[model samples]
Target: MSKSGDDQVRYEPAAPKKEQGGAQKPASQKSRPLLEYSPVYLLVTIMLTLFTAEWLIMIILNMAPGIPQEWATLINALALTVVIFPVVYFFHYRPKVRDLAELKRVSLVLTESERRIRSVMEATNDSIIQINEKGLIVFWNRAAEALFGYTAKEIMNKKFLTLVTSPRYYVFFEKWFRNELDLVKKNHGDSMGQGQFEVFIKRKNEKVIPVEVSLSSVWLEDSLHTICMVRDITIRKKAFVALKESEKRFREALEKVCMVTAQVEANGKIMFCNDYFLRVTGWEKKDVLGRNLFALFIADKFHAALKKRLYESIAMRVEIKQMEQEIITRSGDCRLVMFNTTNLLDHKGRVIGVTIIGEDITERKKSEEIKKESNERLRKANEELQKAQTQLVRSEKLASLGHLAAGVAHEIRNPLNIISTSIQLLSMEERLSPETVKTSRIVMEQVKRASKITENLREFAREKKPEIIKMDLHDFLERTIALVEYEMSLENITVVRNFNSGPIYLLGDEDQLAQVFLNVIGNARDSMNEKQEEFSYDELQKRGWVGQLVIETIVNEHMAGVRFRDTGVGVTRETKEKIYDPFYTTKREGKGTGLGLAIAYGIIENHGGRIEIESDVGEGAEFSVFLPLATERNA
Candidate 1:
């Protein structure tokens, strides 16, 4: 046996030598022969001894050969066999068989142990690896293969630190291993410890992943080695990062919103509040947190009802949307607010709290109240104005009737006097005489004049809406001028038309416009004739000016205009003001019923138009008529 009582051929750790209590261990030591105590050496020695014995038997048989040669050879072979059999059986064959049986048993035990270890390692989701004393990977499991994109054969004997992406972590692992080894050695063959650490590792494809490693050490064949159970935590890390980003976004949004947002516990305690909530309630976050929501912000009068509603909504999991309530601010001032509230749920979907989003509405409520009061005032004012307008219209109507009655009585009196004088003359004649005939003719003429006056009154009183149609103003005026052409020529009046070259289309009653034009032209002719009587013919001839009537058609953005200007005795200011009044005129008796200008005014007004007269006595008059031009919508 070896002096140390250990098999010299087996691998062993070099022991540290000591010289007394404080001696340093020696570094160099002589190595022992590897095959000195092997079973193979014993077998070889036994085989050599048997071979020498057979040689000796052969020699003896040759020396004592009195028998036959063949018999001697047979005896020699038997002796060799007899001697060799026992020697080989006892010294070599038996020992070899027993050793083989032990070896097979040990092999089966080792195979079963290895199978159980592999099964355990493969069953787990975590990657399992083992590294030797030199940091070389000695074992890699199925999970390790999937995690590192490597197979056992590919990674065996490869340095484990090669998979670590960070050099700092690699150095730390080496130092930690050395420390653990030193501790284990100092502990007299005891394991240092088991521990966990995080590190980034690179896969076969050069992709980096975060992993957690649980490390354990073992003494194998007198050498210390480490076993690592690594877990890929990349997905968990991503989830954590995403959760942090989502929280950041939520906080940013809450800070930017204008409405008050807060979370309240089921007991009405404020758990969380946004910046807007603190600002609106005039309270700091420290003052609001953990305070009772109803006792702090809600008015005392609304506290009971609001609490009841909140409890009901929580129990039913219902939302209260756009509900208005009065709240008391931190300054003790009441303000109206609208609140949208809903249940705040946990991960299990169970309602544990309430979320309130509220908007301040005090100013809006005040504005609505003020608007209601203003509307009431406006309604009363409108009623008073309507009454005043009604009284004014009635007074004006009465005055207008009085003037019309007076004018009619005066106009008919002249005609009636003419008829009465003519009748008296006829009665005095007594027989068929020239004076009687002349009186009959005068009576008929006055009767015709009265009838004409009645017709003019009928036309003036009749008020009918004009039949508006699209008509060209110039063409309509030309037709009216044709009707008044003979009258203008008899009065020695010249007519001048300055018409717009472009078509001046207007939506108006053609017949009504024609009558208006004819009346205005006839007025111009009469004005000239009245002035002619005042002037001597020789003086008029010396002036070298015939009565002139100018007609013009014009077009502009909004309206079409027609102007009739005359060189004659124009009207006074008073006459111009009353010119459009019904039954008012300046013509001699029996020459006019005084309804012409008024009739023209009514017709123009019905067509959504206007008339303006500019006149001065003995200077002639100008009449301008304006009508709204036809538009796409009007057409």
Candidate 2:
């Protein structure tokens, strides 16, 4: 007998039927019979028939009245022996011999099948055990012996449940076994008797182990028996526990990390978020998870672009590194965040989602902006300080020059008076010729020019403070322009007035400001005249060279400004440095004393005003005079 595919026991003939001399019988010799004859029935029938025949023979011999009794008995014995012998040989002995041979063949087949089954039970890794209906262990294979540390001789015929199950599980094992047996009986050893369960079993050394047991029941030699396949499960249980522990630790670490972290689906829905993410965004976990990432955290203005970037990264299976973005917090404040993203992939390397790590950089960005502003302010302050320093140095140089001019003017004045007296006396002589008188007049003119130069030097050295009063700057400029109007027209210079519509009131001395304006106009007129002289009449016409003096008044929050723009050959860079120095001139001989601009600069400084010059050699020049507004000074 052997187990089939469905685990059902079956038996097959070990060898086919053979004829005499161990040769297989031919197909022609094999035939089906209409009736099967039993040896016992044949023997009984033959005996009955022989007995009747002997009785009949005895009767016949008696009826025949044989001549001699001995002859009749011998004849009867011979007939009966011959008939009985043939019938028994053909009917009983022959069939019995054939039946015995068939029984031997069946016994050989059963022995071979049993041997094969035993070998299979011994070779399998799982422990195989057999228990009878009485709860006694009937079979123990080699694996069972190794697993339980018991030999077959020691464990056989022992109570399996008592020996293998712990005391605490005795009742359970007994109850379970009883139920299984009942179920097997009810189903007549059907597949319903087979099942599997896990349990803790004790070995012979009293060590306990986890095991999985598969049970099956079958009828063996007219008795119910259960076969158990036991497998050790200690390693599997340990590995499962280890995996759970690792997962728990990973989750804890994610929650406690310092940076924001989140898992988002490809569609932009947030799946998981760590504690830091919620803390930074000022959102609760319940409110954040499963919400759309863009809608919840990203501003409306950035929603479309951020969503597009996210989808594109996922589609391309690429990571996003160091992307700066601004997020809206729960309190309606905006925060700058730096994010790094990685794609989450499945086992097949297909994109499933994305993981993002973000760092809040709002404070850092603010600090950078503040530092940049501080640097800009510092630069402007340094420029202003340099300008002040330059002004101070220039002021010191002018102060020394002023003292020198005062001394020179005093020394030259005495000589100029003496020369004037002499020239006048010479002109008074009675016999003076016309030629002599002309020469005397010329000498007087020269002496008077010298006197004017000395007077200018004295004025330049004077440190008189201006008498401050509120005055309309526009009116003051118009008066100053009136003084030079004739001179400018004679040179064909156009005076373009661009004054403000409203009056600009400033605090400055009328006389001092007028002098400053006259000096600046004089310089502009001379520069244009010089430019005109550079070309002839026809050349000037061809070049379209026209002298223009553009005067404009500008008012700001705290100052009133007057600008003088000239279409003239502008000052050179070398000339601009010494332009405000006393006795320095870029004019022809006898044209100017050059004390005019020096005096103008000192008066403007005393009035708490500044003069700024902007010029390029060929481009023309602009002079802007700025003074504090009367209202600003009072305030």
Candidate 3:
């Protein structure tokens, strides 16, 4: 054939059709002619026409009957061959041959197209399948074979939906397929509309996998067929589920974490805050979001500095670790906070904002301060305890010495008494001279003084229990002062009494308590007398220096106190420490036994009372005696 003729019959795959608006439709293969005559039909028609023409020609020859049968048959054969053969060959046989050649070429084109389509479907990772109107599988690619674990030979003509879909989806799939078939038939299969869905499909091994299926309809011959592109989405589904779980855990951690956490923009605007942050700052989500962090929570005094520092840190992309500051709460209370900050970065590692974690340390600071104060108090208490311990040790020694002195006093008193009797007998002799009488008198005086010293030693050793009774403290002190009134007057000492308005009462032995008061009074008088001796009478008069012994009675809810304040030479610290020891005297020889204060100390201690001394050298001394009141003792 000619090149132009070959071109006319040549077939190429259809290009996509363009609509009026220039939109191109999907390319689809065109349908073949609706009425096409087959080879057998053409052969039958030609044979019948030849038979009718020859029969008429033979009848005409027979009607002549003049020539023999052989010549007549030859004539008939020649006419039929010459007249019908050319017409049949040219008008029918030749055209049919050309048609046969064209069909063969078209077949080759279709075969090549099919080969290319198959190659494309096999190359893709997604499974491609085609199902006919009967819902039977007609086409399956290599990907389909790998995906479903079923070879094309095995799966051909098999029911696709029934084999792959689970039983629970049977009704749904049936309805869906029916509707899709109706749609395809209504469009005459020209509309290659596609639908995509995710569904579970069972593999040949009976293991189910999640898959995404895309369906498009196509007309094959006269029947509508569905084309499916199946992609295994098992990994995608798992990744989606894992991502959701990770988000859930992250959200829960933010809500439940103890530290206050927030995200702020570089400009100090809050972007996000956790539940703990909202709770600590006493702010609602709507109120706090997008607000300035420093303006809302930091004090005015710290606002500028804190904001500047935060801006600097953000600009430099520096992380703050344990930076301490104060944050004001909604209630106008300040909380000490330690902050840790980290830069929040974008995908390109550029800083966008910051993440802040604040730890409240207010209580920790208060506890440390309290601990410091407690340590200081404990130190002072320890010192006071040590002083009391030393005083107790000294008292114990004095008591032991008293016991020894008492024994010695008892032995010496007997000899002094025997000597006194001998002296009385000797003095009774009439022949004795006046000198002897005087000498005996002097001996008696010395013996009497020694006896007094022994008496005081015996008294110091005595540990007599108090005869308890309730007595008016004022009257008791008054009576004791009256006993020393004459002696105080002889020493040119003036007594002053400052008594409480109400009667102060105490429970104690009257005699022992009286002895304590008298001893204190006598010491005061002696100290004043010694001070007065420092100035002669003329100098004392000229200076107007009068020795005063001020007695005061003080009362409290728990105790009754008597204060003896004297204008006398005061005791030194060293002297005060040993002042209450037996025989520890500052008086001249033969003047004092020094047992007075010691006995008084024992008596006051036994009465559940105490004596406190306050004195300075040359500033005189004040001795306060405190005894439990009657009401306090009874209670």
Q: List the residue pairs that clash in candidate 3.
A: none
lDDT of every predicted structure (CA atoms): 0.79, 0.81, 0.81
lDDT of 3 by residue, 1-635 (tens): 00122221122343344465556574333333313557787687668767866887777777886888798778777766776677556654676677777768876887798668767877988898887777778778789899999987778778888665667665655665677778755654455667788889988899899999888876555466678899999999998899789857976787789988888998889988888887777879899889998888988899888888888888898988999998877888888889899898875788988889888888998998999999999999998899679768867876797788789999999999999999999988999999999999999999999999888888877777889899998888878989988778888888998999888888999999999999999888888888878767568778776778999998856889999999888999998888877778998887788889988988998898888899998868999999999986483
Q: Higher-TM-score candidate among 1 and 3?
A: 3
Better of 1 and 2 by TM-score: 2
List, residue by residue over 1-635, the lDDT tens digit for candidate 2.
33455433343432343444556444222222313577787677778877877886787787888548787778777878877776657754666676667767767777787778778988999999888777787778889889989987778778888655657556756676688767655554442467788888889999888888888876665456778899988998787689679858966887889888899999888988999888888999999989988888888899888888988999988899999999888998888989999898775789999999889888999999999999999999999999799889879988888788899999999988988888888877899899999999889888889889888888887888889899988878878899889888988899999999998888999998888998899899988888888766468768787779999999867879999999888988888888887779999999998888888988888888888888999767999888999986473
TM-score against truth, every candidate: 0.34, 0.49, 0.44
Residue 304 displacement (Å), model 2: 8.0
Candidate number with the higher lDDT (2 or 3): 2
| Tens-place lDDT digits, model 1, residues 99-150 | 6677677667766775676578778888988787889887787899999999
Superposition TM-score, candidate 3 onto the true structure: 0.44
Ranking by lDDT: 2, 3, 1
Query: What clash pairs does model 2 have?
Result: none
Please report the candidate that would top TM-score against the real structure.
2
Q: At residue 60, what lDDT does model 1 achieve?
A: 77
Higher-scoring candidate on lDDT, 1 or 2: 2
